[model samples]
Target chain A: MTCKECRKRFVEARYGELNAGQRAEFEAHLQGCAACAAEYRRLQQTLRIMDQREQPRLESDFGDAFWDKLAAKLDAEDAPPAPRPPQRETPARVLRMFDWPRASRIAAAAAVLVIGVLIGRYFFSRGGEEIPLAGSRETLLQPTALEVRAGDYLEKSKVLLLGLVNWEAETPEAVALDFPRYQRASRDLLQEAGYLKTALEDSRQRRLRALVADLEVVLLQIANLEAENDLSAIEMVKTGVDRRGILLKINLEEIRRAQSLPRPGQTSGKPSI
Target chain B: MKDEKELIERAQRGEMGAFRELVERYQKTVYFLALDLCGCRQDAEDISQEVFLKAYRFLPNFRGEARLSSWLYRITVNCFMDTRRKTQLQTLSLHNDAPGENHPPELSLPDPGADPSAPARSHELQQLIRRALGRLSPRERSVFVLRHYQELPLKEIGEMLEIAEGTVKALLFRAIKRLQKELAIYQAEV
Candidate 1:
């Protein structure tokens, strides 16, 4: 056998990975040739040296220090946030005047009612014409609500995209100044985007599904940013957002003002618009 | 083995003492694995901690599909890969040192006693091996470290890596060939 063939077999043989026939041939070649024999010995010696190389030992206090530090970190993470001081109570009259939550809820309910009525009118106008319902009864029955939710997602996505696009990194510090905000927003959006994408997987609104899928990709990139101060990563995320044309695709400002907002009920601390 | 299973179960149930026990059990092995993979003590320490923390976070989802040790090994591998990637990116901007120049500053030869030259030579060989390992791609380096240093079987390595056994063998073959080439000079000297 050639020296090259023998050397190839030697590696497997050294590890006892070769079968009987291959091992026998490798052994025969090693016995026949002085050069191959010398090479085999050298290989064995090298492996022995490698195997004997000592792994560096940690300091004796390493375990204690690691446990202490990690425990502190976990403690900090697990601690509940300090309660905000109670605001001075306003007069009952003033409180009623500025009950934004109640007003917003009422407005939201009315908007949904209007959308339902408009959708009913449109379907009635269409008479017997079949509305392609994406083969789902939920979509067929609640198309208006789904459209509103889609619009809300689109608007939120635009806000994130615009934040990235409008970020002016005049100084090095400025480059990653808003990355934490971007990362949080992207993570929040990613969860929603994943759900929407799956929900729209069989939907007939091809354009909306495609846009959501692309948006998910950008959100994932943003969410996986390794460090808060990584400017290059921020730029990469911005580039991804820009490349997907997420802001331009849906005209989110117009959609937000035109469509009734669908609230998915404060998911993952994300604010509803 | 039953004791280990119980420990994992307790740790999964948010028992910090049980988790600490798990950490104490595998700390040295994980630390050494990280140290070997990273070639830097600080990074190794960080990676080791990250691995344990990640294991804790994801433990409830563990479902006991693989051995706890294997799962921890997988986490160590992933954390090392992530740490290496970040280090490489930072190195691009902050440092221009040669490969393997990031060897742990504390890596000095152990006491030589009478044969000073022997310890120095062994240290040199170790550094050479580190440099050779640094030459490997991340995937190849992980495969090589797990096979050679960790001494995991090919099938287990495949399971840990979530790749086919044939792929593991192929990667192992490639890694060995590359290491052999890198250590060829030592082969000739020997």
Candidate 2:
């Protein structure tokens, strides 16, 4: 192809608008034409040369003076001042009702008032010197024998509750026949008979009632085991309480209430059962 | 005083100050392009002012689909083209004094001076190229400046000039051919 024809197609090809067949034909011609090829190379170099010329850039801050002039013109065009809207009073007024320290003082005063009322009721209700719950001799004696008997019963009951809670059968009487631990514990605790009767009647001492109810179930199981000679039932009862976390619950509540109820001689140690 | 987007928004809202701010920001660049395209300081300033005023009036109509610079470039080129159409240049022929080859004006050595060229041999050649540029058609001159001098992508030139990409490429090719002819004359003389 002639240089003129090649140049015409070259422009079309450069823009990627030439159809595939036309482009192929141009490529084939360029492969064989020296003069057209040379012109094509020169045109590419010229493009390269032009592309190398950087846009003449001034500083980014070049137009500050011109901007100032424009700004002055704009500001001059603002409308004449009009009456402004009347401001409404602020609506969120709770924050203003009390200063920080005043709020703190009111809370402290209420707390002191409550404490005073409690202290007054405690002192005024008593006929004599208000005795310390820990040091009162009579208070100490009231629950000691009862707790000792309850503790013995609880040991056996703890095992039985463990079994019941775990859905295990009662420890068998045959096993009790061999393992005499329950009978021995019951015998040793028989001296606390008087307090047991009193504890059973008192509804005010709900914690004690809960403990007794747990023990009564264990005692019945023990009696049933001995009568039936069911050794398997005894072992089952023992496993139930352990699996159910029953003893831990009753023991924890009993110790808390028992410690609060004064003992005659025993000084409270570290606030325990 | 204001950012570009803020100025554009305010101008769109019919604020003259905002439009003027944009004009101030771009005046020098428009001026330089006009001077380069028209080959005279007076013509360049007139083209630059006209471009800005037209841009201000058209601010509300600008769709903001392209960069503000691209939009401004469109205005500048269009204004130049209008002027060129009014005063159609006659394509001047040169004596083939020298016939060997060198680079085109776009590829000529960089001009570090504020003036178009320094007192150097290459500078004289640059002056000759600038004169030759004035003779080309407005479309050809624009394509040359954008493709080579502005180093704009062909697609961008198409967008600014509102022409097809193929047309831009063709015009660029023709402009380069014209430049090569003028350079060939210089080469033969050298």
Candidate 3:
């Protein structure tokens, strides 16, 4: 055996871990190589010194105290958690099944899809011929259908409010305004206003929506008037119409709707008469 | 062997008394092994406790493929390495260990009846050796202690440490070379 090989096996050699054949080879090398033999001797001496030093003594062992301490810790681990007040299960538990970004993406995608479908139906849906949710895309997207309907409602509301605001009688019986006939007409218009209010919810015409809502409130008050001589109630309705400038707004909107771009196949938006 | 097999079965079956008996059989061996690795009485105790706790928790997974002591030995080494990682590392000093300054851990107190200077020489040698051990990194220290103190075979040491046998030999040689350098003075004296 070479000196390098013998030195490499110094630990195994000193500890007597070598087999008989290897030990014989190692011994044969040591006999011939003085440097390797001296190094081997030094290793043996160092380990001898280590062997002579006694290990430090500790007074304790894994006694009853240690076992008891460990046992208590184990018991605590095994114990069930404290009870909580019963609560309805929340979606938070379901949400925990997915990571945050993935769950949020799923939710956002669903919301966008639902909204896209609704807006698509609101604009392009002419599939079901009988149950048309909104008008055709062109009628709704262009300013034709909504503006025309709003203009008609404004004209009727303007005539009714004008007749009421005109009668400023000093005494209740002196009023010559026809309250019964106007209230009957207003009740009918009030029902139509409810439908228009719902239809106009997603409409782009904010000004028209505001005017219709205000007119509905006034019409409702007028329809509920008690008698023909209830001048106080009529004055309240008239005051509201004046305060809101309902007449001027309706007149201006009617003129704009008349002048707005004409719908397809119609040469003029203006009234023929 | 049969009795050990039965004990392992009982312990696996959640018999607390059987588990304690198993602990009782190997407690000192594990404690001293930990004591040799860490060079502190308190850390040795903590490592021993953690080893058993882990062993109990994982008892159901034990497949009876190896001796229980071998399994516990692996856990003890892993726990030592883990404690080293998680705790703020400080240099290990035998002087500061709980064994007191006069008696450095892993080095016995000088016997009163012996030749006076022999104890001093032995103590000085032990101090130098432990200081040199402290200078080695954690992996070197573990390899040295397992081979030197635990008398583990080089192959078994490799298997237990999840390293190749050749790697174990390399680490062991590196550890011994460092020790030899630290003890050059003693080698000259001898």
- Going through the candidates in the order shown, the clash numbers are 0, 33, 0
Q: What is the TM-score of chain A alone in each candidate?
A: 0.40, 0.30, 0.42
TM-score ranking from best candidate downward: 3, 1, 2
Per-residue CA lDDT of model 1 for B83-180, tens digit only, reads 76776622111133567655433434352332446556677787677666666667777887888788887778888888997787777767666777
DockQ of each: 0.20, 0.13, 0.17
TM per candidate: 0.52, 0.43, 0.55
Candidate 2 lDDT score at position B22: 76
- Per-residue lDDT for A1-273 in model 3, tens only? 778898888878866789999999999999999999988887677666555544554446437767887788788878897797876667986666557765554554444444444433432363563122223233442345555555666666666666566544553323355556677667766775776676687877788888889899999999998887777888888789889888888888877775675767889746542
Mark the regions of model 1 whose C-alpha exceeds 4 Å error after superposition: A1-11, A19-42, A81-273, B89-118
- Please compute and give the TM-score of the first chain of candidate 2 against the native first chain: 0.30
Winner by TM-score: 3
Best by lDDT: 3
> Which candidate should be chosen as best, given DockQ against the real structure?
1
Docking quality band of candidate 2, CAPRI definitions: incorrect
Clashes of 2: 33
The lDDT per prediction is 0.70, 0.59, 0.72
Error of 2 at B33 (Å): 2.4
Candidate 1 C-alpha error for residue A66, in Å? 1.8
| Candidate 2 chain A weakest lDDT stretch, 10 residues | A169-178
